[model samples]
Structures are given as structure tokens and as C-alpha cells.
Target: MKGTAILFQADQSVTFIEDIEHSVYEEIKSQCGCEHCNCKIENKIVDFGTVSPVFWHEDEIDWDYGY
Candidate 1:
């Protein structure tokens, strides 16, 4: 079984948004080998706002690549 879940961070707090059946979240978590997972079957749904930015660009900016 595979599913997806979303985690939200606001006001210095973390919360689980919702769970979807056989979703991308599950696949990602599984691939990451999450050690603290309880493997519980539960679903959650939340309503929020939707907005899009008007300006965005992709460029190879210099970043601190810790190596």
C-alpha cells in the first residue's frame, strides 16, 4: 500500500495536513526510509487558500554547497 501526506509548518509548529490513498507522499516517505513512522492508516483533509506568484525565474545562483 502507498499513499501521500502533507506536512504544514506555521507559527513555529508542524501539523499533518491530510492523507491520500496510494499517493505520492507515501512513495516519497517510503523511499526516504523514515524511521519514526508508525505505519498507521488514517486520512486527513484541510482547506486553505490558493495563490500564485507573478514573477519567478530559474538561474544557477551561487549557494553554499557544503561539501
Candidate 2:
């Protein structure tokens, strides 16, 4: 219900072929839309890579898709 919105894009084919299919993110939060989101990012980190490690709060990510 609350978290961050990391905006980025990537080239899947290139990344996959080059075996460079991973990044190092020093920051991450929830994935839900910013709904009254009180996200408090004290010191957001932007590391190398094309937005590889976009983590979430819980151990597992929650993609609430309308399936």
C-alpha cells in the first residue's frame, strides 16, 4: 500500500546475452502505488547497473495484479 517508485528501463536481450543481467541497488521499499504513501527514505542510494536490484519490504515481492 505504500513504498517507492523506481523508474528505469533495460535492454533484456543485451543484458541476457552479456550475462550482465543484474544491478546493485542500495535502496528499496514497497511496490504498491503511492497511496497516502508515507515513505521515509532517509538516504536513498543509487548504485551501478540498469536498475537491477529493485527490492521490496518483505522477503518476497507482492505484485497485486488483477488476474
Candidate 3:
């Protein structure tokens, strides 16, 4: 069965959580600043019979600067 998920970031950490509730895609699209911000939430496709959901960063992280 298809459901909804929420991918949000906070406290310098990113999280992807799955739920049957509302979709957070618009919320993330509206709040995402890519290179400058991290507090956002998005909807991801989840399939229980196939593969699990994974988190992906929009930009590459610079380990040296830790941004």
C-alpha cells in the first residue's frame, strides 16, 4: 500500500520518517534553501515489498568545512 512520509532536518541533523499522515513535500520545497539551510521536510516514496527509504542531501558536504 502507498503512504506518506516526512523528511525533515533539525539540530544539525537530518531525518526521514514514514507515516500514513500528511505529505510534507510542499513544506520542504517552500523552506529548502539548499546550501544555506537544512530545516526542511519532503515526501519520499516508500515500498515495503521492495526497498526502504533513504535520505539524500541536495549538495555535497564539505568535510573540511563541515557545512
lDDT against the true structure, each candidate: 0.32, 0.28, 0.36
For all the candidates, what are their Cα RMSDs to the real structure?
A: 13.4, 12.7, 13.4
Q: How do the residues 1-36 of candidate 3 rate in per-residue lDDT, one tens digit apiece?
A: 223333444334444444332324343344454433
Instruction: State each candidate's clash count.
Output: 4, 0, 0
TM-score between candidate 3 and the true structure = 0.27
Q: What is the lDDT of candidate 3?
A: 0.36
Structural similarity to truth (TM-score) of each candidate: 0.22, 0.18, 0.27
| Residue pairs in collision within model 3 | none
The better candidate by lDDT, 1 or 2, is: 1
Q: In model 3, which regions exceed 4 Å deviation?
A: 1-12, 20-23, 34-67
Which regions in candidate 1 have their CA more than 4 angstroms from the true location?
A: 4-6, 17-19, 22-45, 48-67
Q: Write the per-residue lDDT of candidate 2 for residues 6-60, one digit (tens) a residue.
A: 3332333111111111221222223223222222233443322343324323222
Best model number under TM-score: 3
Candidate 1 structure quality by residue, lDDT tens digits, 1-67: 3222443322333333233444434433453323333333444332222211111112222337641
TM-score leaderboard ranking: 3, 1, 2
Candidate 2 similarity to native, TM-score: 0.18
